[model samples]
Target chain A: MIVGVMGPEGSYSEKAAKLWMQKYSMSGSELRYFADIEDAFLATVQGKSDISIIPIENSIEGSVGVTLDLLLENEAKIVGEIVVRIEHCLLSKGGPEKVRVILSHPQGLAQCRHFLKKHFPDAELRSTGSTSHAARLAGEFEEMAAIASPEAAECYGLKVLLSNIQDKKENYTRFIVLKAGKKTLTEPETGSEKCSSSACKTSLIVYLEKDRPGALYEILGTFAKRKINLTKIESRPSKKELGDYYFYIDFEGHDSDALVKDALKDIKAKTDTLKILGSYPAFKTFRSVNIDKGY
Target chain B: MIVGVMGPEGSYSEKAAKLWMQKYSMSGSELRYFADIEDAFLATVQGKSDISIIPIENSIEGSVGVTLDLLLENEAKIVGEIVVRIEHCLLSKGGPEKVRVILSHPQGLAQCRHFLKKHFPDAELRSTGSTSHAARLAGEFEEMAAIASPEAAECYGLKVLLSNIQDKKENYTRFIVLKAGKKTLTEPETGSEKCSSSACKTSLIVYLEKDRPGALYEILGTFAKRKINLTKIESRPSKKELGDYYFYIDFEGHDSDALVKDALKDIKAKTDTLKILGSYPAFKTFRSVNIDKGY
Candidate 1:
């Protein structure tokens, strides 16, 4: 199967996509790169890519709203998940002192803002297409430095001026693998029952009953009553009128579990629109680190 | 009161600060411009500014996570709130037969991404410090246009290629006014008893009880049972450890109100920590319009 990913080449999304291929143990998997996440989604939707991997959220950065919005807009189902540890570094050509401008992705820039303010407050912080691009530029220009990955510095032949520059040490990003067709895993096999997703968690996109006040309370109450643990819950504008929203929720158990099955029944009763994005295993856990080291 | 805002001058934040000053009918309010929201917060904390205004969330874009993170980091109280309408424009140097690049702030660039991709499929989308900065560059350079405010276009002497170019027409941004100290306005000689905010609102930061199952459920149950309507609820990283969080909540009715007072008392009983921010009247309904129309 061909896995579509976002890139300027060697971006975090691309790295996450590669890790996903390895985790699935898919041999000889073809890779396709798109300019942005939307392009990757379109490739999957058009059957150009069998599975598409995209970053959905980060621990330090919060939700990737555009990715969530696209998942809701496109009818694609999330068939799997992956989480990758993020490591940032400062790369420069003529060393740190010679650097007049620092470049990185907007999120990368924000993550390193404190470090930059403390060290190089007067230096201009420019936004680039990706961390990889920033590293590439840092390597090419004498008066520029970039906040990126150590791998990126090596790839671009730049000196690593500082390592682990992120504001938070346990920086991790959650990515989803989307497919156009119906999910392959069914029933109990969707959870740990199957070797494919034995350690995986499940995510759901649900819309609640609008006319009833406390309908959302009742819907969340179902999960609470069931003792089901939720990892995340984010609300997005459903493009409907004001006060209407689509709630995207991530939980520990798969749909086939008795508790989840019962919660779905009560949730369906209170929901106006409910769609299952997919049921996949959670990504591998990354160990936490020092926030100061990340920058 | 001295108000701190994020701007180079004539930015959206400056406009919002002016509106806040007028609402309080406080004349000759000093406005201090900062590089970003965090800097403004620091200014307030250091007694350089009495109040700081910053955009916290956008309807189309969801949460501004950095602002939320900064709020959690600094010991500042959220004193008031406002929602400003956002209207974006496309400006250019008059003779652009071939537009190679379009520039905007990262947030603005993200907001208009779909439009840019559809219209200029091959053109590069660049990021700048702000919309006003983009317009200034576009005015000085020949091969560029900018996505910014119409007033920005006028101020920088750029031609308006398009107006209201944003994908969504109903785009609105919710801004939070923060301060180091909490102050309350009660019905007094200058105000009438019929004032809407005499029975004000209260914002709080609460940490959930323990890892016990259904703990948050029980806490939310109290609000539901008491018929308290929640205006907003968001989770931010506690940073003490991975997976721990603090919930920021906003609801109608002051803490002194019978129902709300009971709700707070119950919430505190169940949660690990509860800190009240402040309560004030919402923004006066204001209609914003295009620059040529003098809104």
Candidate 2:
């Protein structure tokens, strides 16, 4: 099986793909890396790859808006999700004192801004395509350093100058797995049909036709009335206007659950656009192997 | 008399600051530039600057999380808001034909990704501290082109080779104006108190004590039932966990409005972290001079 990822080897996306494969007991999956998120996502959408994994959100940086945008634009269905703990390390050929240029992906650099400012304030900060790419560049110069995954040091033959260099503790990145072919969702049944998802989490996107008052509130009322616990709720711009938005929400309970089904029905009627992005298993918290429906 | 912004002279924040001053009829305010949102915001928070402007959200890129995070952490009050239209242009000392490297802030670069891929696919995309900084670099080299505001072209003696080059049309950035001092709130009067805000827009941040079922719904219900229209609603990571979030909501009523006041009373009771980021004038869309109470 071929799995597309948003970055080269040693990227968090690669780690998420590995974790996702392990959870499903699918071993020996071939990982294909792409330079950007759009390419990796489109590879899955166009069936150029069997599956793809992409970062959806980060604990510190917030939701990956482009990923959310691509998901909506491509009608991509998320089959599962894996959360990867991000422990950024400073890698270099020499010591921190000799580091004159600090390179990282924009997100990586932003995440470690406090650390960089405190230690290497004079260094010229540069943005690369991916954290791993920074590692590769750092390997070529003694004065160049990278803020990237610890695995990047190993992949690029560089020394770990400092470990866990990110400004925050317990930084986590969530990656959603997308399959090549979208499963055509049939009409949600009245709880008589068998549950398609063994997992308890469901995600959907909603876009109100107008930026009208009480439109979103009315939609949220559906979930509230059903007592569904939302795990995540985010609004990305529709790219049409400043106030226009597309909300991506994650909540507990499978779509097949009677309560969830009713909420979905009610929300769909209220919003002009409501696309069920699929349900997945709860989560595999980093380093813990335990997986359950968490009912 | 000092106004703070997140970037140098030619940045969108600078433009927003100018617009805000013009709207408030405050001429001759000094503009102080900060390197990042946190600094610009904290300048206002610390009273180092009387007022500071920071980008809150973009039509394409979505909410600036750090700005939201700082607003909540500092308990700063917003007294006004402005929206600046973003028109990224390719600027260089020379024409586009000799350009081999394209530089901008990460957001500017990301916004023009499609244009770059189609025309200058092989050109190196480098990131600088700000788009204006990229313009400065472009001024030093003929081979370097900057994707920046048109004002940057003038600031750095660069020619605009292309205009309106962002991936999407109608791009806008919403900036919230933060003031240093918090006003002491007397008990909210029941229709007896004069309205604190003349503008019809209000902004607030809420953190649910727990990700409990119906928690957020309950808050939205307060506004929905009162018919207070929400113009923008965004969720930023609480930075504690994956599912934990801080919701920022913008609505169409002054905080002094009876319905809005009641909603605030109800929402504050339900959530552990409910901060009224102050009510501000709705907005001054780019190139438009009309300002009203908007009620």
Candidate 3:
């Protein structure tokens, strides 16, 4: 199986794709690198790769809204998902004392803000294309250090002077593997037989009629009256006019479920546009808050 | 009057604050600068300045979420507001022919992404603390251009190699003049009397009760039924649990209006905690958009 990831040779997405290949596939498995998650999805759709892993959300920074926007606009379906626990480390060429500057992705630098504030507040902080790039840069320039993964440090032949330096210990990224059409992996609990049970999530994008009174309420009430628990609801501007919006919602039931089907019908009646983005496993295990370190 | 703005020196906030001082009743103004908007707010709350000018939102980037977060957390009240049209220029000392690198704030660079992609796709881009800082660096270097305001070019003695270089011509930033307590401003159109009419937009921060189901929808239903137009709603982590959130909402219409008052009453009954942040004029002006020059 070929896996698609984001890269310019060495990115976190590349590392993630490699990890997946090692854990679940063959040693000589094919790997494809796209400039962005969108390109990766397109490649998967065009049969370039079997699946593409795209980051959906992060703990500290919240949702990667761009990914959600792309998913809403695209036709790919999420087949499976994974959550990687991120452990950011400060890697230098020789040691911590030799470091006069630090470089990493802006998000990486922000994630480790508290550590930098308390320890290296005076050091010039620079941003690079990726954590891996930062690690590579630090290896080339002895005066520079990088905030990146332990795996990156190892790959770049760097020494980790600090570990788990992120501001929040619960920092994790949820990645979804997308395919052209629907497919299901075996349930984690029961791997004995081929079960026809569907996934438990119904993700949708809804655009309400302009200034329609009670439109949002009417759409949400359908789920409320049916005892459906909404896992998420985020609004983005339709980018057409002021106050115009499209809501992205995730509810706790399959689209085929009677209640969810009824709710969608109700929402369709009330909204100008409704797009069922996808229905897939909730991945509750992958979303558990992990706090293995202190601030 | 003493005005506080975000800067070490020569930031966009400084220019915005100066414009505000010139336009308003600050006949003899004392200007102060802070490193960030949060610091500006604190200085205002602590009586360091009569008012602080802070950028609340940008057209391309949406709201400056940090500014909004600080406003929610701080003690200062917004007294007046303004919008500044932003037109970024590429300033260089080495001429466009010699320029090989571009530098500016990440947001500034992001706003000019389309322009950069078209003209300087190969130019190495870097992030600086502010556009003015980038200008300063460009003044001392060769083969580099600073993406900043023309005002910054004047301040730093850099020549504008490319003016109106931003992707969107209608780029604008909404700035709020903050004070320690609410003070009514004289109506620009009718200076005869103090405008005592309640603010048209009502702002609220709400927290839902634990184990609540459909609480947000039930509360929002109140406004939906009353035909109130919610301008925006953003969810911030309550920092208590994995999925719990505190929602910040803005809706059109005065809270004193019968329908709005009734809606709030119903909402208060359902929400675990709800605070009226404040209400003010919508500030419906396109001062930041349709600019004729690169400022």
Choose the strongest candidate by TM-score: 2
Model 2 ranges with Cα > 4 A deviation: A186-198, A284-295, B186-198, B284-295
lDDT of 2 by residue, A60-165 (tens): 8887767888888886777777788899999999988899989888788878877976898667777776788789889999999999888889999999989998
Q: Is the docking of candidate 3 incorrect, acceptable, medium or high quality?
A: acceptable
TM-score for all models, in order of appearance: 0.88, 0.91, 0.82
lDDT of 1 by residue, B174-286 (tens): 77788775433222212111224334556777787336556656766777887776666676666544345677766666554667778878887887677777665544323
DockQ of each: 0.41, 0.69, 0.37
lDDT of 1 at B214: 68
Which candidate leads the pack in lDDT?
A: 2
Instruction: For model 3 chain A, give the 10-residue run with minimal summed lDDT.
Output: A186-195
Candidate 1 per-residue lDDT, tens place, A129-206, comes to: 668878877777889998888878778888889888888777876778888854432454321224232355667788
RMSD of each: 4.3, 4.2, 5.3
Ranked by DockQ, the better of candidates 1 and 3 is 1
Interface RMSD of 3: 2.8
lDDT of 2 by residue, B126-149 (tens): 767678878887898899999999
Q: Candidate 1, A115: how far from true, in Å?
A: 1.9
Q: Give lDDT per model, in order.
A: 0.70, 0.78, 0.68
Candidate 1 docking classification: acceptable
